[model samples]
Target: MARPRAFDEGEVLDAALRCFWTRGYEATSVRDLASSMGLTGASLYNAFGDKRALYEKVLERYASHSMAERIRRLEAPDIAPRDAISSFFRETLERALDDPEMKGCFVVNAAVEMGPHDPELRAAALASLGEVEAFLTRRIEAGRADGTIQNRETAQELARMLLGVHLGLRVLARLRPGRELLEGVVKPALAALDPHVPG
Candidate 1:
Protein backbone atom coordinates (compact mmCIF):
# COMPACT_ATOMS: atom_id res chain seq x y z
CA MET A 1 0.00 0.00 0.00
CA ALA A 2 1.04 3.63 -0.60
CA ARG A 3 2.22 5.59 2.43
CA PRO A 4 0.07 8.40 3.81
CA ARG A 5 0.99 12.06 3.22
CA ALA A 6 2.97 13.59 6.07
CA PHE A 7 1.78 17.23 6.01
CA ASP A 8 -1.50 18.68 7.22
CA GLU A 9 -3.64 19.60 4.22
CA GLY A 10 -5.43 22.41 6.03
CA GLU A 11 -2.14 23.97 7.13
CA VAL A 12 -0.77 23.71 3.62
CA LEU A 13 -3.87 25.36 2.14
CA ASP A 14 -3.68 28.19 4.67
CA ALA A 15 -0.04 28.81 3.81
CA ALA A 16 -0.86 28.77 0.10
CA LEU A 17 -3.71 31.21 0.67
CA ARG A 18 -1.35 33.63 2.35
CA CYS A 19 1.21 33.27 -0.42
CA PHE A 20 -1.41 34.00 -3.08
CA TRP A 21 -2.94 36.76 -1.02
CA THR A 22 0.42 38.51 -0.70
CA ARG A 23 1.99 37.87 -4.11
CA GLY A 24 -1.09 37.44 -6.32
CA TYR A 25 -1.87 34.47 -8.58
CA GLU A 26 0.23 35.49 -11.57
CA ALA A 27 3.23 36.55 -9.53
CA THR A 28 3.30 33.55 -7.19
CA SER A 29 5.13 30.73 -8.93
CA VAL A 30 4.72 27.06 -8.06
CA ARG A 31 8.12 27.13 -6.37
CA ASP A 32 6.90 30.03 -4.23
CA LEU A 33 3.92 28.01 -3.08
CA ALA A 34 6.07 24.95 -2.42
CA SER A 35 8.50 26.98 -0.31
CA SER A 36 5.73 28.79 1.56
CA MET A 37 3.94 25.53 2.28
CA GLY A 38 7.25 23.84 3.30
CA LEU A 39 6.75 21.10 0.78
CA THR A 40 8.70 19.96 -2.24
CA GLY A 41 7.39 20.81 -5.71
CA ALA A 42 6.66 17.14 -6.26
CA SER A 43 4.80 16.95 -2.96
CA LEU A 44 2.76 20.03 -3.81
CA TYR A 45 1.85 18.54 -7.19
CA ASN A 46 1.06 15.18 -5.69
CA ALA A 47 -1.11 16.75 -3.02
CA PHE A 48 -2.82 19.71 -4.70
CA GLY A 49 -2.50 18.71 -8.39
CA ASP A 50 -1.09 21.97 -9.77
CA LYS A 51 -0.57 25.66 -9.03
CA ARG A 52 -3.96 26.60 -10.48
CA ALA A 53 -5.66 23.86 -8.55
CA LEU A 54 -4.02 25.03 -5.34
CA TYR A 55 -5.19 28.59 -6.06
CA GLU A 56 -8.76 27.42 -6.58
CA LYS A 57 -8.64 25.73 -3.19
CA VAL A 58 -7.12 28.86 -1.73
CA LEU A 59 -10.04 30.95 -3.04
CA GLU A 60 -12.55 28.51 -1.61
CA ARG A 61 -10.66 28.43 1.68
CA TYR A 62 -10.60 32.24 1.75
CA ALA A 63 -14.36 32.40 1.17
CA SER A 64 -14.93 30.01 4.05
CA HIS A 65 -12.20 31.29 6.38
CA SER A 66 -11.45 34.99 5.83
CA MET A 67 -14.88 36.00 4.57
CA ALA A 68 -16.89 33.85 6.96
CA GLU A 69 -16.62 36.24 9.92
CA ARG A 70 -18.05 39.16 7.98
CA ILE A 71 -20.85 37.01 6.63
CA ARG A 72 -21.59 35.77 10.17
CA ARG A 73 -21.80 39.32 11.49
CA LEU A 74 -24.06 40.37 8.65
CA GLU A 75 -26.31 37.37 9.17
CA ALA A 76 -26.61 37.62 12.98
CA PRO A 77 -30.29 37.62 13.91
CA ASP A 78 -30.08 39.96 16.88
CA ILE A 79 -27.96 42.68 15.31
CA ALA A 80 -29.59 45.77 13.85
CA PRO A 81 -29.36 45.96 10.06
CA ARG A 82 -27.73 49.37 9.86
CA ASP A 83 -25.30 48.45 12.59
CA ALA A 84 -24.48 45.18 10.92
CA ILE A 85 -23.71 46.90 7.64
CA SER A 86 -21.69 49.65 9.28
CA SER A 87 -19.73 47.31 11.48
CA PHE A 88 -18.90 45.04 8.56
CA PHE A 89 -17.35 47.89 6.60
CA ARG A 90 -15.65 49.27 9.68
CA GLU A 91 -14.11 45.92 10.46
CA THR A 92 -12.90 45.51 6.90
CA LEU A 93 -11.26 48.93 7.02
CA GLU A 94 -9.74 48.21 10.41
CA ARG A 95 -8.24 44.96 9.22
CA ALA A 96 -6.92 46.64 6.07
CA LEU A 97 -5.24 49.35 8.14
CA ASP A 98 -3.61 46.74 10.35
CA ASP A 99 -2.21 44.76 7.44
CA PRO A 100 1.47 45.58 6.91
CA GLU A 101 1.40 45.01 3.16
CA MET A 102 -2.01 46.67 2.67
CA LYS A 103 -2.74 43.93 0.19
CA GLY A 104 -6.45 44.70 0.24
CA CYS A 105 -8.91 41.82 -0.29
CA PHE A 106 -7.72 38.65 -1.96
CA VAL A 107 -10.96 38.11 -3.84
CA VAL A 108 -11.16 41.69 -5.01
CA ASN A 109 -7.54 41.57 -6.11
CA ALA A 110 -8.10 38.30 -7.90
CA ALA A 111 -11.15 39.73 -9.62
CA VAL A 112 -9.15 42.60 -10.99
CA GLU A 113 -5.97 40.67 -11.76
CA MET A 114 -7.42 37.52 -13.27
CA GLY A 115 -11.13 38.13 -13.75
CA PRO A 116 -11.21 39.14 -17.41
CA HIS A 117 -9.00 36.40 -18.74
CA ASP A 118 -10.01 33.46 -16.56
CA PRO A 119 -13.62 32.33 -16.67
CA GLU A 120 -13.21 30.06 -13.67
CA LEU A 121 -11.79 32.81 -11.45
CA ARG A 122 -14.41 35.25 -12.68
CA ALA A 123 -17.17 32.83 -11.76
CA ALA A 124 -15.58 32.19 -8.38
CA ALA A 125 -15.25 35.90 -7.76
CA LEU A 126 -18.87 36.45 -8.75
CA ALA A 127 -19.98 33.64 -6.46
CA SER A 128 -18.07 35.18 -3.57
CA LEU A 129 -19.61 38.57 -4.27
CA GLY A 130 -23.02 36.98 -4.55
CA GLU A 131 -22.69 35.57 -1.04
CA VAL A 132 -22.01 38.99 0.45
CA GLU A 133 -24.66 40.65 -1.70
CA ALA A 134 -27.23 38.09 -0.64
CA PHE A 135 -26.49 38.74 3.01
CA LEU A 136 -26.63 42.50 2.47
CA THR A 137 -29.89 42.20 0.58
CA ARG A 138 -31.44 40.22 3.39
CA ARG A 139 -30.22 42.71 5.97
CA ILE A 140 -31.48 45.67 3.96
CA GLU A 141 -34.87 44.03 3.48
CA ALA A 142 -35.09 43.35 7.17
CA GLY A 143 -34.12 46.93 8.02
CA ARG A 144 -36.77 48.26 5.67
CA ALA A 145 -39.43 46.08 7.20
CA ASP A 146 -38.48 47.27 10.71
CA GLY A 147 -38.26 50.98 9.69
CA THR A 148 -34.64 51.21 10.85
CA ILE A 149 -33.36 51.78 7.35
CA GLN A 150 -34.56 54.59 5.10
CA ASN A 151 -36.15 52.18 2.61
CA ARG A 152 -35.40 54.62 -0.15
CA GLU A 153 -34.19 52.00 -2.55
CA THR A 154 -35.06 48.35 -3.20
CA ALA A 155 -33.08 45.91 -1.11
CA GLN A 156 -31.41 44.46 -4.19
CA GLU A 157 -30.42 47.92 -5.40
CA LEU A 158 -29.07 48.98 -2.04
CA ALA A 159 -27.19 45.74 -1.65
CA ARG A 160 -25.49 46.22 -5.02
CA MET A 161 -24.57 49.81 -4.12
CA LEU A 162 -23.10 48.80 -0.78
CA LEU A 163 -21.24 45.95 -2.40
CA GLY A 164 -19.74 48.40 -4.87
CA VAL A 165 -18.67 50.64 -2.02
CA HIS A 166 -17.05 47.73 -0.23
CA LEU A 167 -15.13 46.78 -3.37
CA GLY A 168 -14.05 50.38 -3.86
CA LEU A 169 -12.83 50.60 -0.29
CA ARG A 170 -10.71 47.52 -0.81
CA VAL A 171 -9.13 49.03 -3.91
CA LEU A 172 -8.51 52.33 -2.13
CA ALA A 173 -6.90 50.52 0.76
CA ARG A 174 -4.30 49.05 -1.56
CA LEU A 175 -3.23 52.57 -2.51
CA ARG A 176 -3.82 54.55 0.71
CA PRO A 177 -3.98 52.03 3.57
CA GLY A 178 -4.88 54.79 6.05
CA ARG A 179 -7.60 54.46 8.67
CA GLU A 180 -8.75 58.03 8.12
CA LEU A 181 -8.90 57.61 4.36
CA LEU A 182 -10.90 54.42 4.54
CA GLU A 183 -13.19 55.88 7.20
CA GLY A 184 -13.73 58.94 5.07
CA VAL A 185 -14.80 56.73 2.20
CA VAL A 186 -17.14 54.54 4.26
CA LYS A 187 -18.79 57.14 6.52
CA PRO A 188 -20.71 59.00 3.86
CA ALA A 189 -21.78 55.77 2.20
CA LEU A 190 -23.24 54.50 5.47
CA ALA A 191 -24.63 57.91 6.31
CA ALA A 192 -26.68 57.96 3.12
CA LEU A 193 -28.50 54.87 4.34
CA ASP A 194 -29.66 56.52 7.53
CA PRO A 195 -33.28 57.67 7.39
CA HIS A 196 -32.84 60.23 10.16
CA VAL A 197 -29.82 61.80 8.52
CA PRO A 198 -30.74 63.77 5.43
CA GLY A 199 -28.75 62.85 2.36
Candidate 2:
Protein backbone atom coordinates (compact mmCIF):
# COMPACT_ATOMS: atom_id res chain seq x y z
CA MET A 1 0.00 0.00 0.00
CA ALA A 2 1.19 3.57 -0.74
CA ARG A 3 1.92 5.81 2.25
CA PRO A 4 -0.31 8.81 2.78
CA ARG A 5 1.39 12.12 1.87
CA ALA A 6 1.84 14.35 4.92
CA PHE A 7 2.54 17.71 3.31
CA ASP A 8 -0.08 20.06 1.88
CA GLU A 9 -0.02 19.71 -1.89
CA GLY A 10 -1.04 23.29 -2.67
CA GLU A 11 1.48 24.76 -0.27
CA VAL A 12 4.34 22.69 -1.64
CA LEU A 13 3.35 23.50 -5.22
CA ASP A 14 3.31 27.22 -4.43
CA ALA A 15 6.82 26.93 -3.01
CA ALA A 16 7.98 25.08 -6.10
CA LEU A 17 6.37 27.74 -8.28
CA ARG A 18 8.23 30.54 -6.55
CA CYS A 19 11.51 28.68 -6.95
CA PHE A 20 10.94 28.12 -10.67
CA TRP A 21 9.56 31.60 -11.23
CA THR A 22 12.69 33.13 -9.77
CA ARG A 23 15.29 30.95 -11.47
CA GLY A 24 13.37 29.58 -14.50
CA TYR A 25 13.30 25.94 -15.74
CA GLU A 26 16.82 25.43 -17.13
CA ALA A 27 18.43 27.02 -14.11
CA THR A 28 16.24 25.36 -11.47
CA SER A 29 17.33 21.93 -10.24
CA VAL A 30 15.33 19.17 -8.58
CA ARG A 31 17.30 19.71 -5.38
CA ASP A 32 16.22 23.35 -5.45
CA LEU A 33 12.56 22.37 -5.85
CA ALA A 34 12.85 19.79 -3.10
CA SER A 35 14.47 22.28 -0.76
CA SER A 36 11.92 24.96 -1.48
CA MET A 37 9.00 22.55 -1.39
CA GLY A 38 10.13 20.91 1.89
CA LEU A 39 10.23 17.44 0.44
CA THR A 40 12.86 14.75 0.14
CA GLY A 41 14.13 14.21 -3.40
CA ALA A 42 12.52 10.76 -3.44
CA SER A 43 9.25 12.12 -2.09
CA LEU A 44 9.24 14.87 -4.65
CA TYR A 45 9.80 12.40 -7.44
CA ASN A 46 7.14 10.02 -6.13
CA ALA A 47 4.55 12.78 -5.76
CA PHE A 48 5.34 14.98 -8.78
CA GLY A 49 6.91 12.49 -11.20
CA ASP A 50 9.90 14.59 -12.36
CA LYS A 51 11.18 18.14 -12.63
CA ARG A 52 9.59 18.60 -16.02
CA ALA A 53 6.30 17.25 -14.79
CA LEU A 54 6.36 19.51 -11.75
CA TYR A 55 7.08 22.50 -13.96
CA GLU A 56 4.12 21.59 -16.14
CA LYS A 57 1.89 21.58 -13.08
CA VAL A 58 3.27 24.95 -12.08
CA LEU A 59 2.43 26.36 -15.51
CA GLU A 60 -1.15 25.16 -15.23
CA ARG A 61 -1.53 26.67 -11.77
CA TYR A 62 -0.10 29.96 -13.01
CA ALA A 63 -2.53 30.10 -15.92
CA SER A 64 -5.51 29.42 -13.67
CA HIS A 65 -4.56 32.15 -11.24
CA SER A 66 -3.41 34.76 -13.74
CA MET A 67 -4.75 34.66 -17.29
CA ALA A 68 -7.75 32.42 -16.69
CA GLU A 69 -8.90 34.35 -13.64
CA ARG A 70 -8.47 37.66 -15.38
CA ILE A 71 -10.50 36.50 -18.35
CA ARG A 72 -13.29 35.25 -16.13
CA ARG A 73 -13.52 38.45 -14.15
CA LEU A 74 -13.23 40.90 -17.02
CA GLU A 75 -15.53 39.01 -19.34
CA ALA A 76 -18.50 39.23 -17.05
CA PRO A 77 -21.77 39.55 -18.97
CA ASP A 78 -22.46 43.00 -17.56
CA ILE A 79 -19.11 44.43 -18.55
CA ALA A 80 -18.70 46.34 -21.80
CA PRO A 81 -16.23 44.66 -24.10
CA ARG A 82 -14.12 47.79 -24.49
CA ASP A 83 -14.11 48.35 -20.75
CA ALA A 84 -13.16 44.75 -20.20
CA ILE A 85 -10.22 45.04 -22.54
CA SER A 86 -9.12 48.30 -20.93
CA SER A 87 -9.43 46.82 -17.49
CA PHE A 88 -7.32 43.85 -18.49
CA PHE A 89 -4.44 46.06 -19.65
CA ARG A 90 -4.85 48.33 -16.66
CA GLU A 91 -4.60 45.42 -14.27
CA THR A 92 -1.60 44.01 -16.08
CA LEU A 93 0.17 47.36 -15.95
CA GLU A 94 -0.58 47.68 -12.27
CA ARG A 95 0.73 44.20 -11.54
CA ALA A 96 3.95 44.95 -13.36
CA LEU A 97 4.37 48.19 -11.46
CA ASP A 98 3.67 46.56 -8.12
CA ASP A 99 6.03 43.62 -8.53
CA PRO A 100 9.13 44.75 -6.71
CA GLU A 101 11.05 41.74 -7.97
CA MET A 102 9.84 42.53 -11.51
CA LYS A 103 9.08 38.90 -12.37
CA GLY A 104 7.25 40.02 -15.54
CA CYS A 105 5.05 37.02 -16.49
CA PHE A 106 5.51 33.30 -15.91
CA VAL A 107 4.06 32.08 -19.21
CA VAL A 108 5.84 34.70 -21.30
CA ASN A 109 9.07 33.93 -19.50
CA ALA A 110 8.62 30.23 -20.17
CA ALA A 111 7.90 30.87 -23.86
CA VAL A 112 11.11 32.81 -24.27
CA GLU A 113 13.36 30.70 -22.04
CA MET A 114 12.38 27.09 -22.85
CA GLY A 115 10.31 27.33 -26.01
CA PRO A 116 13.29 27.02 -28.33
CA HIS A 117 14.64 23.76 -26.89
CA ASP A 118 11.68 21.89 -25.40
CA PRO A 119 8.81 20.95 -27.66
CA GLU A 120 6.37 20.16 -24.87
CA LEU A 121 7.10 23.38 -23.01
CA ARG A 122 6.95 25.28 -26.29
CA ALA A 123 3.51 23.91 -27.07
CA ALA A 124 2.31 24.58 -23.56
CA ALA A 125 3.58 28.14 -23.69
CA LEU A 126 2.01 28.80 -27.07
CA ALA A 127 -1.30 27.35 -25.94
CA SER A 128 -1.36 29.59 -22.88
CA LEU A 129 -0.57 32.65 -24.99
CA GLY A 130 -3.20 31.62 -27.50
CA GLU A 131 -5.84 31.84 -24.78
CA VAL A 132 -5.05 35.50 -24.31
CA GLU A 133 -5.11 36.16 -28.05
CA ALA A 134 -8.43 34.39 -28.40
CA PHE A 135 -9.89 36.39 -25.56
CA LEU A 136 -8.66 39.64 -27.08
CA THR A 137 -10.07 38.71 -30.45
CA ARG A 138 -13.46 37.96 -28.95
CA ARG A 139 -13.59 41.22 -27.03
CA ILE A 140 -12.51 43.26 -30.06
CA GLU A 141 -15.15 41.63 -32.20
CA ALA A 142 -17.80 42.38 -29.63
CA GLY A 143 -16.64 45.95 -29.31
CA ARG A 144 -16.67 46.44 -33.06
CA ALA A 145 -20.20 45.10 -33.37
CA ASP A 146 -21.38 47.46 -30.63
CA GLY A 147 -19.72 50.46 -32.30
CA THR A 148 -17.33 51.00 -29.41
CA ILE A 149 -14.16 50.06 -31.32
CA GLN A 150 -12.94 50.93 -34.80
CA ASN A 151 -13.27 48.41 -37.64
CA ARG A 152 -10.24 49.63 -39.56
CA GLU A 153 -8.84 46.11 -39.38
CA THR A 154 -10.33 42.68 -38.88
CA ALA A 155 -10.64 41.48 -35.30
CA GLN A 156 -7.93 38.91 -35.96
CA GLU A 157 -5.39 41.48 -37.13
CA LEU A 158 -6.14 43.89 -34.31
CA ALA A 159 -5.98 41.14 -31.75
CA ARG A 160 -2.64 39.95 -33.10
CA MET A 161 -1.20 43.45 -32.87
CA LEU A 162 -2.56 43.84 -29.36
CA LEU A 163 -1.13 40.47 -28.46
CA GLY A 164 2.26 41.70 -29.60
CA VAL A 165 1.75 44.78 -27.47
CA HIS A 166 0.84 42.61 -24.50
CA LEU A 167 4.01 40.52 -24.96
CA GLY A 168 6.09 43.67 -25.30
CA LEU A 169 4.58 45.07 -22.11
CA ARG A 170 5.45 41.95 -20.14
CA VAL A 171 9.04 41.80 -21.44
CA LEU A 172 9.66 45.52 -21.04
CA ALA A 173 8.21 45.57 -17.53
CA ARG A 174 11.04 43.34 -16.37
CA LEU A 175 13.73 45.64 -17.75
CA ARG A 176 12.21 49.09 -17.24
CA PRO A 177 9.23 49.00 -14.85
CA GLY A 178 8.88 52.72 -15.34
CA ARG A 179 5.28 53.86 -15.28
CA GLU A 180 5.65 56.47 -18.01
CA LEU A 181 7.60 54.18 -20.31
CA LEU A 182 5.29 51.19 -19.96
CA GLU A 183 2.16 53.32 -20.20
CA GLY A 184 3.64 55.03 -23.24
CA VAL A 185 4.11 51.64 -24.84
CA VAL A 186 0.51 50.55 -24.24
CA LYS A 187 -1.26 53.88 -24.79
CA PRO A 188 -1.19 53.92 -28.54
CA ALA A 189 -2.35 50.36 -28.79
CA LEU A 190 -5.35 51.06 -26.58
CA ALA A 191 -6.03 54.31 -28.40
CA ALA A 192 -6.27 52.50 -31.68
CA LEU A 193 -9.38 50.79 -30.35
CA ASP A 194 -11.31 54.01 -30.04
CA PRO A 195 -14.07 54.30 -32.63
CA HIS A 196 -13.32 58.01 -33.19
CA VAL A 197 -9.55 57.55 -33.45
CA PRO A 198 -7.94 57.49 -36.89
CA GLY A 199 -6.29 54.21 -37.77
lDDT (CA) per prediction: 0.87, 0.92
What is the per-residue lDDT of model 1 for residues 65-136, given as tens digits with 9 covering 90 to 100?
778767885677888988888888988889888899988898898889889998998899889989889888
Per-candidate total of colliding backbone pairs: 0, 0
lDDT of 2 by residue, 1-199 (tens): 9889999999999999899998988899999999999999999999999999999999988887878989988889999999998998999999999999998899999999989988998898899889999999999999988999986789999999999999999999999999999999889999999988977
Q: Which window of ten consecutive residues has the lowest lDDT sum in model 2? A: 60-69
Off by over 4 Å in 1: none
The lDDT of model 2 is 0.92
Q: Report the CA-based lDDT of candidate 1 relative to the real structure.
A: 0.87
- Compare the candidates by lDDT and give the number of the best one: 2
Candidate 1 clashing pairs, residues 3+ apart or interchain: none
Worst 10 residues of 1 by lDDT: 190-199
Model 2 vs. true fold: TM? 0.97
Q: lDDT, candidate 2, residue 75?
A: 89
